[model samples]
Target chain A: MKNTIETSDRPVTITIPEPEYPLHTLSVLVNNKPGVLARIAQVFSRRGYNIESLVVSPAAEMDFSRMTIGARGEESGLDQIKAQCNKLIDVISCYDHTDDAVVSKELALVKISVGASSRGEALQIAEHFGCKTLDLAPESLVFMVTGDSGKLDAMVGMMQKFGIVELVRTGKVVMTRGNGLT
Target chain B: MNAEPRDGAQTLLKCLEAGGIEVMFGYSGGAALPIFDALETAGTKIKFVLARHEQGATHMADGYARATGKPACVLVTSGPGAGNTITGIMTAHMDSVPMVIISGQQVTWMLGKDAFQEADIFGITMPIVKHSYLVKDAADIPRVTKEAIYLATSGRPGPVLIDMPKNISQGPCDAPLDAEIDLPGYNPEKAYEIDSKDVEAVAAALAKSERPLILAGHGAMLAHAGPELKELAETARIPVCNTLLGKGIFDETHELALGMLGMHGTAYANKAVCEADLIFNIGSRFDDRIIGQPDKFGKNATIIHVDIDPSEMGKMIQPDLKIVGDAKVVLAELNKHIKALPTESWLATLDGYKKRFPLSYKIQGGLKMQHVLDVWDRLTESNSIVATDVGQHQMWSAQFNKSKAPWNWISSGGAGTMGFGFPAAIGAQLGRPDDVVIAVVGDGGFQMTLCELATAVLQKLPLKILVLNNHFLGMVRQWQELFFDNRTSGVDLEGNPDFVKLAEAYGAKGFQIKRPADIEKVLTRALEYTDGPCLINCEVVKEDNVFPMIPAGAALEDMITEKPKHRMEKPTGST
Candidate 1:
């Protein structure tokens, strides 16, 4: 075997990944007011930015609101918007998570067509994705899955190959990875 | 009563007076002649403002209602006279203004025989009015009159109608004068409460989530929850987005402001909304315009919906936590329970997006409409009220005009009415005399109610008219270019008369602007003139269109950013 091996052989190659656009998760603190949202929306509207998943509620200890905004944009523009928001009397603060650590997850409910023939495969897939069968009919099955948006989307794509009837998704909900409350 | 004096017409006038109606705008007609004659002879307390047109009369009454927050009454005769008030009635309905329109009908004997100058006025106005009543007997007159006023001024105010037969106005019985009418299932002061369990669930979710988005709608405006919404967003470090109807609810100048979200939303705002991790909807019904496709919307986030209307919750998109309550109350309680969260990274990301795709419009190397808006912005005070007719100009004003306070911007939102601004401006101006009033109308829209100039002159109202004359119905032309393959339909006004002459005819001064240089000076002159009403028609290029347009039914991201390449295709002869 050694005598038959070639002298020169190609090395198994592993390419280094290129630098990517920074992903950021932001928590926007604002006043719950009419037109306040419009004003905030105008900032994104005029600029043509895309928001990922957003969650809003009032803070635990104040008379203000909390908005969790996920988005991908250049660093400078995001900074300008944050600064602008901070200048508003109603805006308490804005936190960007691109440079900070955060935890985020998304939830989805999918209704898929599962005939008797595909029932076993559908159940198997649902079990693998940690999804619960919320509604199980003779002809169809509805599964509820909670996870990151990407994970849910992947599961949905896998299920789509069989047959999808309808789907409902809750956008992403996020939190900081650390214990910093402010 | 001395011998129980019984004149049918006089009795009707007395009933109207008893109903607490101080004034009425109307025109005389055949079937209504007796009522008018009785009004003249009885010397009733009610004053009358005779209108040249029935439409004008209705609008005057509408103006009175919007001004006083009371149901203003209008009187019209049978047949076409009653029909003429339809446009004004529709206007009031669309804007949710309160008005009571009374129409005289043929005598009770000839009610349904298709008599001359007779019409099924009640049936015709049914869809347009909140309620319509047909007076069959003289005994029902007093009760109907009071009920009509009450219904018109009640919850979510709108127009109400009372059709008076000629004989009913004359025939008499014991006056049905009482302040009470039992209306079942009409709860004007209904209050909604949030479920405690749902509030706790939402609080827990907020405590855990890092990135959140708040979407506010017109319901917040109606609820007067702007302050609470602002407080919640700020304290929680959440970004906010708004729908078109909710434009002024949040201050646009806020840093966390994502601008308007929907088909016509700014690119940044749409992107932010689409990419948000959690979407909390407040006082908004997630209209299709706001959400492009439910499957594609908030694809990566949990949606928390809070609304006063339970039916609205989870109707469009299911929420992780559905809190049914008034926005103000829910926001207040949520604020008390949620701790402050860090959103520096989120703010930084939004800021970057804001800079990369700023809201920009082109000038076309000529007189820019921005200049006109800028001039108005400078001259008008914060208290100065502004109304706009539906078109590119209205959007432009919405985009440019900085309203520092509430109720300063009044326009037909859902209806997108073209001829609304002229009459509405008159009404708003009349309502708030001390506040400066300006109506920004397009040339096409202005001509629709150009007759109202006479009303302004007659009333001696110092209303200012800023007509952005592009010689076309700008919005329709834009649509034609975008959707109709550039076939400019009936949208141009090339052969129209000089507006200055028209204004002079109505005893008002008019200023015309064609060149870019004249805008500021003309606006200054128009604003300075404290005399009678003045019109400043800025003759902009005929083909210019508003940019950053969201095509109908498209996602907010698919906005038209620059000027369209098509240029009128040589003005298809005689529009």
Candidate 2:
């Protein structure tokens, strides 16, 4: 089948650079039922949009669940994915909060192997970044931090200077301040 | 409600009756035995057509949906039976046909445990189904059934699945039969609400453009927008062309009709599309074959697209003006607002193209596929439902078998699945028992699902089957000749069965046409047979290549209207 046409004739018309497309955040509200999350996740991957991070929790009511997903892809694809997800019988609504006037927060637990002298500096950095000291082992300290994704990235960057042992983070839960329902 | 405790299977039947499914196709198995048993004592309004294969049953359901414009039903067991329906389900999904597939599942406890005859069918068919449900409790059966039927038939209709577990079906439940559909997120009917502003804008665009044309698709046919389409074309004086699925949307004999447009479409239609100043795409997704060069296609025209599906808008050629609504409502509104536009000279130009480069072929050497279709269409009077298999014969039928009615042209577009024609034709015949139904299959594709002949013959379906025996997979062979230096590999049908004998073996009459003179005699005799299924094995010329081809990805202007002079030599001892 490939030999049927010249190379120039193929319909490879559009080539947009991937780096130009930034990460897009979406808040999807769906029915709190079995396999709803999997269906929502499959819609994104089917359209080639990978979910960087996803947060699922009960919504304003118990019957529905709010899924805050960090999705990255081209803008058009994100728009299409939002429409596709909305078409699902389980999904009530989906909004890309990447550009919305809203507030978001994520919780991360970072454990770093610190020496006895550097422990004080690490504690100082954690306190400056609004981190809570969750635990302290003989040679390591676990810091619980909460902030927006950007702030958490900056905090993680600062902590990376130390010998970071392990890390776990929740999805970025978001809410509009005034009246917008995501 | 009966108030007496009806079992889960009986509850499902009552829900199906509520949803207005008159008939269904299926094959019974262990997981499906409960439903089958319930049908024996109940289901007074439902009729079941037993198929030899699950895949055949699915295609049969698909054909019923395509022909009747109503949602059709299919029932199959779990595991292999459920797995076999993926192709047919995907076929309906791609073409946007309305269908509901019921696959009997393993007991609730055995699910996901790799139990006997268990497959994660709900997971396997997620991408293909418009919506799916795994019945956990027997109480949810009524809701799932109502929702599945409603979803399958609404808006951009497609297949919906219900994975009914064996335990769920056999268990007793006290659920109400009139379970109100509780879908908060699903609102398919809203797409049918048309805004007058869009109609005005389209009318204004039509009034301004000097050269405008209409490109129809299967969506238009599904929407039953034929009368409105004809009204709009006549009112706006726009020349109309169609996709393969859009065959009978407009009467082919009408002056405004430019047959079909795209790859293997008529040369005049392709040229008209490339040369038009404004192109109104109604109910048609701009498939790749239609738009030859994405960059070059419609570069000169203001493309206007109206469809029910919003995802289709930006997936291909982005129209300058996009309207999301049902085709009938949109076209009807446009017809109400618009008067005739000045396309006199433009029509004359298209007329010139049609006269100069018509859909033509030479049948001098031997009996050709084109001539076979020509005679069939003439004898059938172009009013019957014509289902075609994939390959050279399919394209030739698209070019020659012009349709005269709506929902009469059934083929597996987009998926282009072979072996779809025979079963689909049987389904169409059953759906429209009075209307003439025919399946023009190739030798390569007919053998794919010939086992379904038993299903058709046992029920006494009056199907006219035309087996175009070209002795090779002619489409790939043509490609190999043109592009692969004529090194045809796995295309020969050396072990092909005698189709006449095979049809007779299945208790159907069979005939043969070996020469040009035998075409009419055999077709007429075959068409006159009303006993049951009939077949005609016409041995056609083996090397004929369909013309007016826009080589994959080539610009529409670069279409090859006729065979090139330098061609590979014909294989010896052929034709």
Candidate 3:
């Protein structure tokens, strides 16, 4: 349904700039309880902010879990969201990858329909992207790839010409690269 | 002095009463059996209505909230039970109705392992609900429950979820009943602080502009500022245009009132909005639907947007003056700053346009939806509440019926959910038992949740339902006929059940109006019998279309004023 409210005729476009540096991830420790995720989400939702990717799992210790959240917002909006998360009782700690040393990886599986003419080209593209063939059906090939979300997105975009039949992505899952597991 | 050991379930019942929740709608399932068991043993004051389906439970809660303006609660089991409530949650969210949805999850230890009937209820509902939480510790139940209710009813109201694990419900905890939840940044009444200079600039623009228009939104209804808005518009003698969600805020029959605006808006209303010199927007988010192609919208006018949320000020289309403040307070202050101006010439210009494109329907030979709205106008008091489902019927109700009071027209505006009318009417009826409550639904929309008729019948609530039986998804078919080469796909209802029989099955009186002559008599009979719920199914022409339509992607000035020659080829009976 539409609103018939009058408005100004002049076109106004506000272009939000991309981050100055490469995108980063955050590892957040929160209470593994009901509503904790919601509380964390409320911090973003109430501000009309959007999270690019989020993955939640149990932490090394019981009664606690970790969520790897990826987002791109203006500096102040991001700061406000992080501060809001810190105030929730269930949240133990939050670390921005830009400020702290962390490791992030994303996994994706792509099924491509390849005819005889495109089979070799599709395989070549997969090898170029370091993707392994998971399944080789008579008419299709499934490739499994793991990397940062951006790299995976690029790989998917490159393979679109081969006629992607299906795509499944396990969103960005991150940890502290090595030796440090919180 | 040792009291009987209380389980988490009993404690939950105690907390519910303490939190002032009088009732809940839910069904019993394996995961939620513990709570039901506790209810049986504890003999709590809270009443639980057993719903046939989880969706029904959520709809009941939605109705209760709409009626009472309080957060009504619903309970469901883990996994599929919880998943079934998503559509209703989305409906409530889209309509901005307040509700607290509680779903039982698997035991805490088995949460991530894909246990029986286990699903990520919180994650699944994240986008739909206002806020969703999973309660891990039994001790935090009281605080979470209180906070959920508080959050659901506060701000731009919507659904909130509380997913409790089975173990938490059966666990032991010692927490005070008044465990305060100090949510550091939680402030429900936070209004955006608008700059004084912006307000002054808008006031100056309004003072100077000869053809200033006032546009109201759902925010105006939320703030209960309808009276203040009407006063400001009438005092300033400015024309008022309303969003679909903002309908009924101003008397549609008023001289200054321009009918609902947007894609399906009347020609005169859309023309006025598009051509105004200065537009004062109050408590509305300028959604894309209202301002089609923002770049070309309101090019001739200056927009002054006033909203409580600061981000909404320039989120979509930029405004000339952006003021972030409570709509009521802002309108009252704007009223104080400006004196009544003579808009006789502007009114005359609009009146001429209104006369050129007056809203009317042919009274040829059979029952028509417009005729039903006309009867509704005569039968219902000014304060009567009218709820509508999403379809061509909803548009008809908005266009043909006259609403004099704010909130009297309840509908799923943003979401456009089909099954909202029946339950919302029940809620509105329950909210104000002294006033008449009517549900205006289409044949397709009425069937979406016709089971709610049992809720009204069992509760002995008097809700009059007027179903426009076009035997097709009227709106979709209209679009298909107009834009899609008339290739009707999944729009026709070939084998639908008899609605009168369906009403009879629910123990409600049913009236069928098949001819133009039967409209007044059938409506009078339905209005006369006020003992229980009733349904009036008016079998309108199956191919009838809503006219004066602005085709999709078309500007307001380019509306289809007359029905196409092909559509008029068949002389379908009308009223």
Best by TM-score: 2
Candidate 1 predicts chain B with a TM-score of 0.84
Q: Give interface RMSD, per candidate.
A: 20.1, 1.2, 6.3
Superposed by TM-score, candidate 1 places the C-alpha of residue B60 at a distance from the truth, in angstroms, of 5.2
Task: Provide the lowest-lDDT 10-residue window in model 3 chain B.
Answer: B566-575
Of candidates 3 and 2, the better by lDDT: 2
Question: Top model by lDDT, which number?
Answer: 2
Q: How big is the positional error of residue B419 in model 2, measured in Å on the Cα after superposition?
A: 0.7
Q: State the displacement of the C-alpha of residue A116, model 3, in Å, after optimal TM-score superposition.
A: 46
lDDT of 1 at B436: 78
Q: Model 2, B476-536: lDDT tens per residue?
A: 9988887678899999999888889999999999999999888898998988889999989
Cα lDDT, model 3, residue B96: 75
- Tell me the lDDT of model 1 at B250: 76
lDDT of 1 by residue, B92-168 (tens): 87666678888999997897799999998977776577667777767666666777776676545678888888877
**TM-score of candidate 1 to 2 decimals:** 0.67
Comparison by DockQ, 1 against 3, better one: 3
lDDT of 1 by residue, A1-182 (tens): 11111111222222223324455677777766433454555555545556655677787745667787776566656765664444333466677765656677777888777678888998999999999999989878899999987799788877765566676776766677769643
Q: Residue B454 of candidate 2: its Cα lDDT?
A: 98
